[model samples]
Target chain A: MYKLSISDKAFNVLNYGFLSFVLALTFYPLIYVLSASISDPAAVSSGNMWLWPVDITFEGYRKVFENNAIWTGYRNTIFYTVLGTLLHLCILLPCAWALSRKELMAKKAILWVILFTMLFNGGLIPTYLVIKSLGMLNTVWAIVVPNVVGAWAILVARAFFQQNVPDQLVEAAKIDGASDFHIFFKMVIPLSAPIIAVMALFHAVGLWNQYFNALIYLTDQDMYPLQIILREILILQEVGGDSAAGAVGQTENLLEQAKTAELIKYAVIIVSALPLLIVYPFLQRFFVKGVLIGSVKE
Target chain B: MELSRVQVPSTVRRETRFHKIKKRFLKSWQLYVFLLPALLYFIIYHYVPMYGVQIAFKDYFVTQGVWGSPWVGFDHFLRFFDSYYFWRLLINTLLINLYQLALFPLPIILALSINELRLGVFKKWSQTITYAPHFISVVVVVGMIVAFLDPQNGLINNIIVAVGGEPIDFLTSPVWFKHIFVWSGVWQQLGWGAIIYLAALAGVNPELHEAAKVDGATRLQRIWHVNIPAILPTIIVLLILNMGNFMAIGFEKVLLMQNSLNLSSSSVIQTFVYKSGLLEGQYSFAAAIGLFDSMINIILLVTMNQLAKKTSDNSLW
Candidate 1:
């Protein structure tokens, strides 16, 4: 074997050093947030805690749990994620499957029409107007129905179908007297677990992280998602529900409330982001595959 | 009959092709049945909006409806072009996108560096750490920014004081708005974006690397000559895709990061559309702006695609 050059060795050292720097930069904020969430509110605000928890306490989490609106937002977000993802799959998967089939009528025309939407959409106001005209304003339907089928999702799922599900398999199943529905339900769905998982995860993460839709559509506080509530607590600084009930004593009390609010902001960030971040690494491979699949032109 | 079959006319060929289509259509009825809901969904959600975009040309009222509204031709468009915030919004939007585009080479660099790492737990760990931020919601990310940049008692400010420097309020500063928006986006999406190039790099032929090594090329040289060229097409395609979305910046994050103090820098076309249309109840005007934005995006996409086709042979089409 050829010996490594001194320059190559030096390059390797620098490369590893740069990557390590990136890793640390990305990781430090997450650890800081996690640390600050459990730290005492005053200790956190006073800059005593940076990398690790200082004066550790569960007060921030307690306040977050105590908030009625947070729980409502949590429940509403869960409902939207579940309902929206299911509807998304129901509409997207079968449509993708149908489009993937060589036998489908007007396939080119249908695909072109769908693909055109990706290049040029009606923009925000008109879509919002359509939703308004449909009388879906201020309701759950407004959140779930509008984005049930994505063109990129269709392309990704369709690519997976075309690559994995062979025409011969369907033909054999048909020859054996299996109907199209039977083949799809029994054969195609089983073979498509990986793509289905990818699609489901992507859609679920989208719905879970969705706040803009809810912000615009749903005016009612009870229908607010967790992200929306987090916005109120974190950005808007409107965490004035039951948590502020004890802020009765004047300037010092108000100061104490603001400190606690800062603490809750950290905890809220951790709490809202914890689920997806925890699940993402384990399912990271499938997510990568989904992106790769989308990038590969048919 | 035999002579006629040998010299079949175009009409007869079309009729027989129609028959073939009919037979296949009859056989695949279930496919159509399965596609019906999606078809209806597209019609209502997507196509109807395209139809409703006509209100951009009309003086739309809820009472008049989209079609019933009187046509004002180019009044709203003219009003937008002549408006004071028009240039600000246009420049801010393009500047942010151009800033993002300037950093487009970053993920490719990350992917190359990450690709150079020996396959092991350390490599995996680094990727995992970098990718975790992508999973964080925009609200939480913005929340973190707000908290970390808080003037009096933020982490960054505290650090600044530790270093004996003035505390800089990042969120409120107009100068800092675009940098904050773009950098936070880069931080969030860097690892995620690198995944595509990583995928491309994985497909680079191993033999090319061996050949480069046999020629006594250094590691960096091999990476530059072999790997970079291999992924050039992928890079071009992705760059073209990014250009295609030039005007369609992440409205959600910008909107979240926006405030009165930083409105000069943060108020993009998309956020402007949302405010004027939804919040301020100027549906017709906002639709006009939205329509203009979409038109620019389409033009950029098509133009970029054409350019890519001519130069690189890597057009999305």
Candidate 2:
């Protein structure tokens, strides 16, 4: 039923043209990186390749696999992501449910305590000291335990519960002689599937992308996450690696190192991010609903 | 509703201690059980470290632990206050945050513009493209930037040569560091950030647009009058939250982007804490700085919340 004005048609054309241009600008560099990573090291250094790859080879990936540290980083990162997400969900879901309930004694006080942390905190050093005092430093717990309950995730889940789960449902369950736990399990949680999916996706993406915690707490190179390893590789390249500074007999070739580093950076990014990216399309409906629910009051 | 059926005993008996404990536990068991995991997390991760805050007031030795570390009584704070790099870090942090504040409205504008577009497919495609980059890791994002901006053979520099201008070293320059960081962040985040605004726009009444169209109001005029006002509350709330978090820039991107040449501009509170606390083992001092930074953020949050409450009814509380 909609009709486009002549000017509107022109405008639409112009908008699409502009959008395509912007999209190309946004994506080209990423494409270039992917292509360059697979390109021959000599060709990449000589500036022969741009827009498309030249002398394509899997040598970079091969070298990256040979580095024991990269695999160690992957192992450590996956462990943290999985353990952290589970711990986060376990803490967040019940706390959010409890906070949403009005009848609980000291509910207001508890909510305030939780909200206080959201607003203010002792900074990194204080947090680190606490971890150290707990004897978690240089351990996997140090990386996973501290950030297990993100306030934003809690807030989102709470809002979802408040909006979607009617009090009547809980009351009906209670009337049927259901305990609070039974009511929550039977009535509240099943209705909150969308929000939980959104939370899981958000938390998973965050854990996968995280590097700062690992960088701070874990000192063992064997315990390093992928991002930290990538960082070391990048820094090594910037400083011309160990070989360029007249260090003798470092078996790794500089060109080969650069190629591998470049490929590994892209590959790690793809690997770390691919799960969330794939998960997002299917969860898009729920994500949009969750965001809408959370932001509606604002 | 079910609680109405319970008959209360009129006799207020001073019960036995065991009975009292049992009754209290029965009433509050669900609350305590619900709270237990979060409380455990708080104790292990939050409160236990709170004791470590004393190290900021002490000369901490790793072997001595928190209790054994001798108190220096504000010595680290004084040292930081007198340090030559204090002003540099403070100013750089404030300036970069200020730049981010200035840029905060851009995504909203983009969202509004996209919403105004009549073509659905084009708008959807545009949104998808813009939001795609946000998912890319900061490491890869920075890598893309470096490759593109490389003076020797980068696509950007190659274009510069075509235009007869010499290639500029964007990454290494201190002047360009904040711009690169903020703008790239904006580019990556604009679509994702626009989501809230789009939701707000969707909530706007269709009849208002129809009425405006009948009144001969231009598309821009209708958007300015109707759409903008509808989303104003969200805008204000988001603004308050953004201002509150102004100091807490994500350290990852900045850390990834920093080279020795640009460290002068890029070394914020977070990176400083990471280096000093974890690497150099000055846990107490780093904690002090981190505590100071968080205090500033808390002050900003409280002040902004109060201001929003006064100026408008919208507030986080």
Candidate 3:
């Protein structure tokens, strides 16, 4: 039977106390936002909605879903994430597969080139110019194509292939007169389901959160993703100020826009974030493994 | 030692090495075929952009192609160096990275505290909650920060007024901007950053702790001697890895957080480039600034890596 000393007990109490404190501190802000989204706009604006909903109303959520631009942004974001991740896998998986091979010619040189680009890029302006030159700006291809290579993703996938897919399997396939391409496509890809899923999820989440590229590349509002449009709405609210709330007119005026915008900010936050958050717990197990594998090489 | 050299003739050695390389290439050309798409991607996207970096030295025009553009050697670079915003951009970029580096060990501390727990719900919940914020978008994070820091109606202000203190508008205040940005970053990244150290700490042999217990070492002593040393290499590697991004301050978040009132402190190199190049269409000037930023990062990374190697005798190489 083991018994903790006074010092150990003190440490345990302190540790548990700090952990709980952080748990509350990190979680309470999110709860407040969720509660505010469901509360009356006036209640939220007055800072009355704290830990729970005040004068519960679904007005904010209703307006957000009804907005055509927001809906289009959602559609665009989904398409980008799906198509972007597929392109990522098509480029990344094979690169990883080939690089992981001990027999691949110029492997060291190839890896050096990849790693060199990883550390130093041509900077944002040059990259943007290159994309613009390719006539990809404002197109869906701009959102997905130039984003084909993620250096870290390729490195992680390569590391996974090296560690998990054994040399013995490749050699066995070779002895059976199977080509290197056949071995990688048939044996390697199937055996690497966990890594593939992890890579896909990681890439998809990144693409879903993407707005910076769109901010620069795409000029049209209809082409805007959810994050960008939401940001614009947020910026509009700030610029509109208290006048937006006080001013009323015959049209859908500044006052109405202000109230709806305030509510919609919270609703948009929840809507954009909900899918990833819901999938996170299930992906948590894979991510832990994925991150650990990636970091260990560094 | 001479007998162990296998007595191969020098002429035959070259032939064998050549033959071995040829055999491997003949057996593996199919893998090269697999590599073509990725190779083309790198050439088109990455290498082509790299080629375009030469535009920083030229008076670029859409009418004239890259090679046809007249070169004004170092004009853009000189202009950037002499620009009024140069020092401010440089300092702001450095300070943000400095704070990030200073705060690097915090996640390790969080992990250490969590590891101290024998096992409990607190451990599970703390891990889950801390990591959740990392997934939130930058725009939402800035929105939350603005809402929470609103001078008249924010929660913090409400608490301040309740306690008979003055409410401060944190987001708009220049003094408060860096703190808000840095601490919020800590909040978001704490768990994700700790994952590697936690993995390392978990890999520590339990027998070492048991041995320390038998030797009458206290809990603090055990953690300090055992856990700290175990994760030290990981900590250094991550530090070096982070230093590699010394110039990259996640332009997205800073861009989101920047307002007219807080532009003095919030306008980093990245934002500067975005504003100048993307918004104002001064492509050459922005590219020059961007090129300078990359150079600074590379230098810092190399220096830090050297220092890390000298101090700890560990390196990425």
Q: lDDT winner among the candidates?
A: 1
Docking class of 1: medium
Candidate 2 or 3, higher DockQ? 3
Q: TM-score of each candidate? A: 0.95, 0.88, 0.93
Off by over 4 Å in 3: A238-252, B1-26
Q: What is the lDDT of candidate 2?
A: 0.73
TM-score of chain B of each: 0.94, 0.89, 0.90
* Docking model 3 quality class: medium
Interface C-alpha RMSD per candidate, 1 decimal? 4.9, 5.1, 5.4
Q: Give candidate 2 regions above 4 Å deviation.
A: A1-14, A38-48, A54-56, A65-68, A238-256, A262-272, A296-298, B1-25, B151-153, B161-167
Q: How would you encode candidate 1's per-residue C-alpha lDDT over B1-317 as one tens digit per residue?
A: 00101111233358888788778878888999888888778778887788888889999989888878999999999999999999999999999999999999999999999999899999899788888898899998999998989998889999898899999988899999999999999989999999999989999999999988888888888989999999999999998889888998788999999999999999999999999999999999999999999899989988999999999879888
* Per-residue C-alpha lDDT of model 1 across residues A1-298, encoded as one tens digit per residue: 7677899889999999999899888999999999999998778777899889998898889888898888899999999999999999999989999999988867887887777778877788988988887889999999999888888999999998998998999999999999889999999999999999999999999999989999989998889999998888888876755655564676766666566577698888888899898888899998888888989876
DockQ of each: 0.56, 0.41, 0.50
* lDDT accuracy of residue B140 in candidate 1: 89
| iRMSD, model 2, in Å | 5.1
Give the least accurate 10-residue stretch of model 2 chain B, judged by summed lDDT: B1-10
Q: How well is each residue in A44-110 modelled by candidate 3, as lDDT tens digits? A: 7676777899999888788777777778889889988889999999889998999988877777777
Chain A vs. true chain A, TM-score per model, equals 0.95, 0.85, 0.92
lDDT of 3 by residue, B146-260 (tens): 7788787778898888789998988778788889999989888888888888889899999999999999898999999999998899888888889888889687899988989
